[model samples]
Target: MKIAVVGATGLVGRKIINLCEKYFDSDVDYSFFASSKSAGSELEINGNKIIVQELNDDNISNFNISLFSAGGEKSKLFAKKFLDKGSFVIDNSSAFRMMEDVPLVVHGINEEIITEKTMLISNPNCTTMGLVMALKPLHDEFTLKSIFPTSYQAVSGSGTKAVTSLEEEIGLGDDLTPDYSDGFYERPIAKNVIPLAGTLLENGYSDEEMKFVNESRKILSIQNLIVEPSNARVGVKTGHGTFCSALFENNVDVDEAINLISKFEGIEYWADRLATPLDAEGQNDVLVSRLRKGLSNDKILNFWVVSDNLLKGAALNAVQIAKHVSTL
Candidate 1:
């Protein structure tokens, strides 16, 4: 199989390259594609030096599959170009995710929706990816009435620059000045919490928060699923934690829910230990812990979920989508 990775210079892009070497068999061939400024550079993978090429109209047909982690604008502009050239574009951006015709997919949860003929696949937001994985098995049996989620997201989700901002402001304990340079936040991220993650849209919900609601609805195939989410940017460098209090249609027990959740393929459920963001870093499974009864409602329950935003949430999901395609 011939694979190409757009945005090869970015963090998620690098992770995807690493997975190709880790997951794919020795028959796989890779072509790294990035912007013109990074065209002449090289990306080292599995002891091999792969030259990065400039992404353009002329070179779109060079692979059987292309993984894109550039932002939404870049995916909007170029994803279909790869498809037009017979490449399965597994976009890791939000660009095509919400489109009605486009299939928004996670590997084990909703992967059956795609086949060899599926030309374009949209990867869910990193937070949404982890949240839905935990929600699926429960929703499948008890049927979810509603979801209330609050996320403690790592700075790395905002990109490499946001990671730098957190590193740069580590010792600025009391300096409250805004660090709006390359970071998503308009305020200091070190020792401080920003209530926002993505840009605030017209509806007053930050784009990242809305992703939890929208993507959850689609992947679960529940058109009317209700979700209320709050996304925050924490100082941590990786992993995203989602704390959700849910209401089900039936009265449920914690042990029963854990058993159902354990039956799901991509989630690891533990009742004895608390799952932290750090626990999920560099790993592929969504970790579920802190399960308990919710207040004020017999049908309600609360649980904590965590996963590596860059790995299981983004890069691994994209690679798994391609792996499904490979089976076709």
Candidate 2:
């Protein structure tokens, strides 16, 4: 089988390449693509050196599957080109996610939506991906009525420049007098938290916050499900954390919920200790802790979820979808 990895030099793209080796067979043919600026660079895969090609109309190849993380604009231009070549396009961008026909999938949760005829799939936002992974299992058993989530996301989710900005801010030591001239974020991201993570819309919610509401409802097949979301950018570098409170139609049992979360694939439940972003930095599974009954009523349940935004949130989810298509 032949596979293509676009945006091969990016933060998420590099992780996807690393995970392709882990999830796919050794003999599968792999091709890497990047923007013209990053083109001609070489990446090692399976004991061989592979050169990254410039992503353009001329370089589109006939492959079995193509994973795109080059951003929405590039995906809008190139995804269907790969699709017309008879390739399955699993996009890791916001481009095709909300389209009625495109299946927005989080691999292990609702991947059954993918079938023989479905060719283009969209991976969810990194924060939404981790949030839904924990919510799916509970929603199935308790029947979710509403979701209230506040996300604490890391700078890595904003790309390499944001990560560099955080590092630069941290380098100033105890002095907070540095000019905010060159930073990517609106506020200092070193020892601070920004309440708004994405572009603010007319409705007063950021794009990232709406992704949690809209994408989760679509993935779970709940069109009118009530969701109130807030996203904050934190000082960390890897994991994305969410403190979620959900209301269920039926009564929730804490023991049964823990049991269900533990058995679900790609999730780890912590009953004895609290799970934090530090513990979830390099793990493939979403970490859940501090599960308890909400103070308002018996039907409400609250929990904390964390995961590696680069791993399970982005690259791991995209590659897993490709693996599923390969089996068919």
Candidate 3:
């Protein structure tokens, strides 16, 4: 079988390429594609050097699956092309995520929605991927009512450019000036936090914030679920952290909630210490900690979650979806 890794030169795309070797059989053939600028550049896969091809109509070919992480625009342009070629498109972009016909999947949370008939799958936002992983097990046991989540997302979510920008800005330590000349973020992000993560809508919520609301509801299959989202971009490089205050229909036992998260698939629970972004840097599982009852009600629970934004949040989940569909 053959597989295509679209956006192969990108941050998440590279992760997907690295993971393809781990998840797929060694015999499977792999092709890498990037933009014209990155095309002709070489990348190593399974110890063999492969030239990155330009993602265009001429390069498009029949493959069992195509993993996409370029951007929404690229996905919108190229995904259907792959689908028409009888390939399953696992997209890691905002494109087609909320579409009724497309399934927005988080690996362990809602992967069962994928079937033999499924071809196009959308991976959730990096922040939502971490948030929902911690919430799903608790939501199943207690019936989630509402969630107020504040995300401390890393600059890596914006891709390699943002990561470089953060590093460059950090080199100017204590400059205390907003310089938009280098970074992908609107404001300075070296040692400061940007209040908004995505384009702000008329409703005063960012597109990233609403992704937490809409994608969580869609993935969890709770149409009326309430989500109050506030997302911020932090100075970290890899992991995305979220602080969630959730209310459930039933009273939650702190012990039981901790136990539930501990045993849940793709999650690691820390009982004695809080999980930090640095701790979650290379982890495949969502790191969850600080579980406790809310001050006001026993039915409310508060916790912190962290995950490698590039891994479980984007590329890892996309590859996992492809692996699952390959089995089907």
Model 3: how far is 308 from its true place, Å? 0.6
Spell out the clash pairs found in candidate 3: none
Note the Cα lDDT for every prediction shown.
Answer: 0.87, 0.92, 0.92
Please give, for residues 1-328, the per-residue lDDT of candidate 2 as tens digits. Answer: 9999998888899999889888988998999999898888898777778899999999897999999999899999999999999999999999999999999999898888998689999999999999889989999999999999999999999888888888988897687443566577887778888889989999999999999999999998989889999999988988999999999999999999989999999999998888888999889999999999989799999999999999888999999999998887
What lDDT is reached at residue 157 by model 3? 93
RMSD of each: 1.8, 1.1, 1.1
lDDT of 1 by residue, 241-278 (tens): 98999898988788889998888888999777788877
If scored against the real structure, what TM-score would every candidate get?
Answer: 0.95, 0.98, 0.98
**Pick by TM-score: 1 or 2, better one:** 2
Q: Mind sharing the TM-score for model 1?
A: 0.95
Summing lDDT over every window of 10 consecutive residues in candidate 3, give the lowest-scoring window: 175-184
Could you tally the backbone clashes for each prediction?
A: 0, 0, 0
The alpha-carbon root-mean-square deviation between model 3 and the true structure, to one decimal in Å, is: 1.1
Query: Residue-wise lDDT of candidate 3 within 1-328, one digit each (tens)?
Result: 8999999999998999889989988888889999999989999888888899999999899999999988999999999999999999999999999999899999888888988888999999999999999999999999999999999999999988888889898888876487555567888888889999989999999999999999999999999999999999988888999999999999999999989999998998998878899998877889999999999998999999999999999989998999999999
Over 4 Å off, model 2: 177-179
